[model samples]
Target: MKVLVTGAAGSIGRVVTVGLAELGHVVVGLDRVPQPDGEDSAWHTVDATDADAVAAVFEEESPDAVVHLAGHPGEASLPDSLTSHVVTTGALLDAMVEHDVRRLVYASSNHAVGRTPRGGPPEAGPVGADARLRPDTFYGVAKVAAEALMSLYADRYGIDAVACRIGSFLERPETVRHLATWLSPDDCVRMVAAALTAPAPGFAVLYGISHNTRAWWDLAPGRALGYEPRDDAEDFAGIIEARPEDEAEAAHVGGPYATAQFERPALDRTS
Candidate 1:
């Protein structure tokens, strides 16, 4: 299948592009970042916030699947950050619609439900897919809006939308919170690939997290997507020390990222 990965130069987008190619799909890398003169990527330079430009690429490529990863990422500085991110995501959806393209694997975030309490005790059963969208920050708000767009495009336009509410994707499973939420690079590849190829994923919001002992994000709806996450953080528990009790307290909470420096967040959301 032909695939288009917007924001292909970004951390996660790069991986997704390469991963799809390795899986034998023809992949095109789209980004505002200028491509090298003789690049291997079927690269295109376009602003995601400009629907006209984005649509032109989609129309030209006519990709069977689109992994919408491009956006002006949110920052904690209130309204300015929100404007950039919210506007960019809107452009992404409008363009996708204009082309009559379906099968979109949206790159959403755990922050969409980050404010929900993370239970210390295991719930009787896993969390449901119908959980509320209670975001903790402007960043999370943008994700919620984007996820809503996916729903609208799928239900109203007869498209297939898989909003992967991705958890943390780290280079190494270090922090205690990461042990529960870590989505390794390989697992990231698997989740996105599953969402793209799923026969029928009509308007679904599924968590993109690996199997770990402390995981709180629900994965029940992801079964239809065929996402069998293979990595586990437990194997590295002994090598990484936990954060101090106070820091761990905040980080282990569902709002762990609430403590994150919004002005210059250290965490890599793109991953």
Candidate 2:
């Protein structure tokens, strides 16, 4: 299968692109950042928000699947962030429709349900795709809107959309919260590959996390996509200091991003 990976130079993108190529899929990597030579994938520089540019790529590549990961990755002030996420996502969806590309693996975030309380009853288990939207920041809100766009396209255009509510995707667990939330790079590729190959995913929202013992998110939805995560954060659980249950970060599913103040510094606005 031929695959187009947007934001293909980012941390997760790099892993996914290489993993897809190793699996024998032709991978075309698109990003504003130019990739170094000798990579397994073919790279192209394109700002995602540009509809015409994105359409041209779609027209040219005509890929069998797309893993949409390009966006303003972190929480930021209005316009620029919105353009990077929502606007760019809209452009991609439109281009997908125009080019008749049916399969999409959207990079949604756990922050889409950021306000949910963590550590519920042990038997209750973690939240699933049916979890309510509780965006904790503008960035999360943008993901919410993009998810809606995916739904619209899937319903009206027969697009097979898989929205992955990804947790803290990192190479390693950095903080205490990450023990439950961290999604290893290998697991990230596994999940994306599942999304790409799933038989009939019309429109589904699924969690993207590893098989962590203390995971606060469910894996059942991901299983439907053929994802079987192998890495577990608990392997390094003894090394990282655990935060007390009473800490604010331990209380919400969003972690520190849930409570961060978003006021823009004066110097930042001048840029």
Tens digit of per-residue lDDT, candidate 1, span 169-259? 7766877777777888898999999999888778888888887776667666776679988788887788877556435334423445555
* Regions of candidate 2 where Cα sits further than 4 Å from its true position: 243-246, 262-271
The residue-by-residue lDDT of candidate 2 on 22-83, one tens digit each, is 88999999999898566846777999888999898998888888999999789876566678
Q: What is candidate 1's TM-score against the reference?
A: 0.87
How many Å off is the CA of 110 in candidate 2? 0.5
Model 1 stretches astray by more than 4 angstroms = 36-39, 72-74, 78-85, 124-126, 245-255, 260-271
The number of the candidate with the highest TM-score is 2
Provide the overall lDDT of each model, using Cα atoms, as 2-decimal numbers. 0.75, 0.86
Query: Candidate 1, residue 234: CA error in Å?
Result: 0.9
* Structural similarity to truth (TM-score) of each candidate: 0.87, 0.93
